[model samples]
Target: MTSTTASRPVGAKPAQGSNLSLGSLLRRPEAGAFLGLLAVLIFFAAFGGLTFLKPAGMSSWLNVAANLGIIAIPVGLLMIAGELDISVGAMVPFGAMTVAVISGHYGMSIWLGIAVTMAFGVTVGLINGYMVIRTAVPSLIVTLGSLFAVQGIVLGLTVLITKSTSVALTVDGPAKVIFGDFLFGGQLQVMVIWWLVLTAAYVFFIHFSPKGNWIFAMGGDKVSARNAGIPTDRMTIVLFVLSSTSAAFVGMCQAILYNSAQVAGGQSFIFNSIISVVVGGVLLTGGFGSVVGIFFGTITFAIVNQGIYYTDFDRNWSALIIGVLLLLAVLMNNTFRKMALSATTKKKGA
Candidate 1:
């Protein structure tokens, strides 16, 4: 046999140019989002001054990101699986009220309250999943209907039980310590930990595991995915359950954090979470995005949304700026997608 040389390998292919090259790096799924995040950070640092960079200032957006990210990540995954769940808006309050009504109003065991709250999440999630799988109705329409249905159920039940729209609780023991308490010099909420853990879990599930390929294939084309032996129906249902349960978890965390729940407060979560997911680089059409991209996208949004508070800009113009920035971000994501695909095609041909 010929002696193997360190200088040359028989079967190894040459490097596809430098890994550190701009084209190479920008082709990464998270590149567009990373650049967007950087731009926002620099812009905010310029206008928001030193306080904006301080821990106190950081907390302002980090806290917001934690709450938004928890929802956005799952929504992004659902989108990647080619689905949507606007019902989460109603699920949030429904979950909180589940706990609030059972434990707070009825003075039941807090443990029971928590269990029942999550149980309802499981129930609604199953319902949402089953309807989506069995029916050809677009997920948007299905969830939209569920949104109103859940909202009505919540309102009617809360009114019937507590006789008011607002319900309150005083969380104590481990529930407060684990779910609601602040940490790290009393600035960061414990929810941040939950967000990080879940993000990693999703990243692994969607990126490192074979299941991720199934999700991507589902988004690429459910028909083809099923033909390839993937369980599209079951996957869709599982994703729906995850999305709904995530919203409920966030709702429960909020209830524990603030000791209150309301019928109307979670509506903003519907719009806000979608905004965060879109900004994070998850295409509205699905099958294209990353957990990291969504993570950075969330921070970008939080910075822009919360940075306005630290700047001298008029509050009224904030919405306009947000809309502009979001459009620009989507444009950037689309452009990068084209470039990445072109580059890959060229490489294959080469």
Candidate 2:
């Protein structure tokens, strides 16, 4: 028995590498984004003068983050789960318009309008997910189609119902209290608090939960995950639905805050949110990212994208800075991807 045990096959010992705590973050995709954010802050503080660090500047940038972070969070999750939802731009308007039409034009209760808006968002999400999973179509294509289709539907229906593209909302009482209330300074938005809280909760969930593990696994390798008993299809669908639902909620919140909804309100978010997610360290190809990274990324993008205007630099330079940032993000993503793949090879060799 001892001789047989000696001859039995056993796995090789793990390789000894660098004792770098938490691994080489430089080898991590998010490292570049982290560095980039610090660099931006330093540059702005040095050149943007004292105002860049002031409460007014803080409010300006944080407000932008709050608005953009909502979509960025969901979009980041979808990317991590190995999918996309370009339709969120339209979904935002869809939810807002649904509420506007129901509450403003149809004389329905605010709660009913809110319910209808959420339900419509859910239905759209389900349809998008079902089609993607059942047909095995690329999420990019499916959501792109959904984006256009929803845009058309929202435009046509809004025109048909209200004979106008914009709807005025008269929100008061609790709605105003929830959306318009300020927590810190007259500049601080309630949405800013909401964004931070949601980011922390999502980070906790993604890092600690079994479901979050499944999400990452499915994104990393769907076939391997399914073989290992993960419900890849269901997870994919649920992710898409979650993305849509979040966008809808943001839209509803905007509607309440602004007390108006326009058919064209969310169009800019399609590109902006994607850019923010990419800048944060989430790979477009899927898997290997963090909600904290995205949170930081959104803040970075918001500051850089909006802060440029306050600088002596021409506003056109804003576009240039964003482009440069995006190029850098792409380069960092490739570098980290190569490292991750190499890690896999090293594991196998060991």
Candidate 3:
């Protein structure tokens, strides 16, 4: 729905950039996650001992974190902007397969395939945004539908064209070098650089720009945001499109890195991304979160998800541990929220 500049609550100052001070560090959005990372490290080191802190071990965990963090950052932005796009789970496979189709099966250039993948991403994002706006359906349902529909389409099309569910990609080229090559003494994947760049860019935009305030407003209350002169619909569309496009970009990278794409490869991302976001302290209900928190949260999740494999623990126990982590994260988030609100109330009372 269109919003106009007369409905926002009076006296709403634009969202403020973080004020830096020693005090500010404690109040930093990601402070909780930093503590959580330390806690995780301590727990693993105490239990798994030296193996948990090995360079090779650390690299593996960071690699998974980097891949997931790429998508998490964009999705977190979209969340901050007050929209959702579950279709990313599907978009991952879609983009990868699209790349594979163009570059692998059709003997097309990888750059060309990457471009097509991006274009397809934009199209899918446009459709998602349009459907959400037109029907006023919650994005959860809209994107979930997109998720399944896209998944089916990818599977059906892959089988129809290649008669195989998996495509082996010969990803040796400039595209591979650009996306999949090792950096940081060959201990880090190139995508880690991309993640850091995206995170910094997001932090700058959301913290320093007027448009960032608009995003916070949209999430706080769309109708009120519209009344206050914010273009909620346009912002929503842009956020969704960005979300999808980011997923597609990551998918292309993965296809090149792995040298293959399977229709089912992206399924884990749906939940994994959400877990990271939530652990970062973004409320499921929207309106309050920190991107830096998400960055650390993604790291924490990656450590737990991948690091668990290094231990002698049973695989099933890893799921159990992750579940416990999720529960603890939610519990701590609520406690912190209450504490912050109480402090705010006390200050006003004084």
**Which candidate comes out best when scored by lDDT?**
1
What TM-scores do the predictions have?
A: 0.94, 0.89, 0.89
Ranking of all candidate structures by their TM-score, best first: 1, 3, 2
Pick by TM-score: 2 or 3, better one = 3
Q: State the C-alpha lDDT per candidate.
A: 0.85, 0.81, 0.81
lDDT for each residue of candidate 1 in 206-268, tens digit (9 for 90 to 100): 888888889888998889999999999989888888889889889988888889999887888
lDDT of 2 by residue, 258-346 (tens): 77889996877888889888887887888777787788788888888778866788877887888888888777767876876677467
Model 2 global lDDT (CA atoms, 0 to 1):
0.81
- lDDT per residue as tens, model 3, 49-141: 767568778778888888898888778777776677789999999999999998998889888999999999999998988888889788989
**True-structure lDDT of candidate 1:** 0.85
Off by over 4 Å in 1: 1-12, 18-20, 347-350
